[model samples]
Target: MSPQQKALLLPKKQGNFEIGSRSIPSPGAGALLVKIHSAALNPVDYKIKDLGFFVTDYPAVLGSDIAGIVEEVGEGVDNFRKGDRILAHGKFSNDFAAFQQYTLTDARFTAKASYEKIPSSESFDSAATVPLGLDTALVGLHGNHFGAGLTPPWTKSVGESKKPIVVIGGSSSVGLYAIQLARLSGFYPIITTASPSNEELVRKYGATHFFDRNLSGKEVKAAISKITDSAIGIVYDAISLPETQSVAWELLANDGTLVLTLPASVKEDEGKGRKVISTFAGPHDPQNEELCSSSWAVVEKWLSEGTIQPNKYEVLPNGLEGIIGGLERMKLGQVSGTKLVAHPQETQ
Candidate 1:
């Protein structure tokens, strides 16, 4: 029998998660076998259990944000070796998922971790908060088909864009990354809305102007007009709630694209020429593979230089068992401005 590892498994479609044992998978060509240290929870994890939309197989593991140490490297992978600390965005498949002590990771989606180095600001828990949220923001802002079709900062040769961009729910995990990416893309007057308590937090992430989330659509639009005359060409609605979507639509200029992490709540009108693109992020998807690969290639440097900041995280106790309550909190809208992380190896 293969080596056994503790995993949080959803036994069936729309089923409850339970602690279970699964075989540690081996890395195939161009992959790495990772011993997961921290797995961060996202809204999609609970949504998958409730809606059963993303996974077709039963008895599945669901998590996308993974940070761990490489146990073994597969053939053709020369950059990573055994014992290297790394972080990678996981997939829906059981063997590649993050809710287990051990899983396989594609080399292309993995990045080096400085978790062990002195003076390093990153750790497994913090790095685990980055993958899914950052990828969603990247695809929403730069993906031609999945997003606004803006030029990526990594490849663009132009100077500061000086254009205005708005991020709804700026305190959200995806919202945080959207703000950072907006700054990197040279979008000035980065406007965002969040709770008063999170205004400082959002500003630290590069939101040049902040508004109260309670502001009505017209209120925000009127306030934004005073900040910049530049047309609001991109409104990344990381929240995607009906109220937030309405505000985003109000602030968007004609011909502008609204990027949403969830399905658009507002209908696009033919007469307005406005476009709404819902982002589907994950390197496993062929549509996102190329763009994700480019961003993943620079992840290590970005983390090292603090070009990208991980979200604030609270590590849940009880390892795998703690994830259940974390998901419940997320589903109940009890968790805010923070990512919940669990250490799978601590399961007992």
Candidate 2:
């Protein structure tokens, strides 16, 4: 009936999030109006927020990962209904952002569950964390643009290769999700690198071998070969430093596949048939749009079963007002292995 919804406003280039009144959007056909419960903060949030690369305009509402309830569904929508408990990785183009009390979501991006029976086992703060990280991981795994279709060539059987992919940053939100998804997909021998303190923590997420990144690439490669038995297959480089990408490439067995979150200095090695891949993380990819619903279904199943867990979160308790500082901190790399969550309930 009226407007004046509070949003975490991004006022200008290098600007941060803030609380400000905004209109509550009405959903069009195929879109649902969700009363936002939580907004998951991602590295990309700060990347675009501080750098001003993707803003349609200044003073934008910045959030792409969200979890909440569908308060209203637009005409022609049958996949979800009023009061359905759901979470989503919003389409970044419409900026189906959730730093506000309410936002638009296409039926495609949402995953539904009944909050009553599930008891909201994962807190709102933790729930939104999964959609982004898990979606990214799931897409990489499902694409199989990688070598041996996510299992290494040398493995005895595809079924025995859990974590066959050696993800370089296993403790990262995306990296952690990739490890779990790899485990879920029956890929064994998952290898990853992080701070030494994170070994056991990441192992719980299905990282069969957690190496210290501080080690030389030669040492890291040896560790990888030990579990994968000298057969490195698919690799997901969640943290893509140019040097790191080169290191990941070395570990790949000849004719291996390496998928980097960012494009790296990978070239066609004449003797080795390794292929390099770059993935777009959200709805932008025509490939991703088709996979969105199915992928979310897979992620939702794991969530329901408690087979995967959220990254550690520095969840802000307030709504939009509390988000500004969090975004700034994210820019400085202050939030590592911990997601910054925004609660939109107060504003809603």
Per-residue C-alpha lDDT of model 2 across residues 92-167, encoded as one tens digit per residue? 5433787888898877777774433245755566778877787677666665442124432123333553336788
| Poorest lDDT segment (10 consecutive residues) of candidate 1 | 113-122
Given candidate 1, what's the lDDT at residue 44? 95
Q: Give each model a TM-score.
A: 0.97, 0.88
Question: Candidate 2: which stretches are off by over 4 Å?
Answer: 93-95, 113-122, 144-158
Off by over 4 Å in 1: 115-122
- Candidate 1 lDDT over 159-273, as tens digits, reads 7778899999999999999999999998898999999999999999999999999999999989988889889988999999888999999999998999999898899979989
Question: What are the lDDT scores of the predictions, listed in order?
Answer: 0.92, 0.73
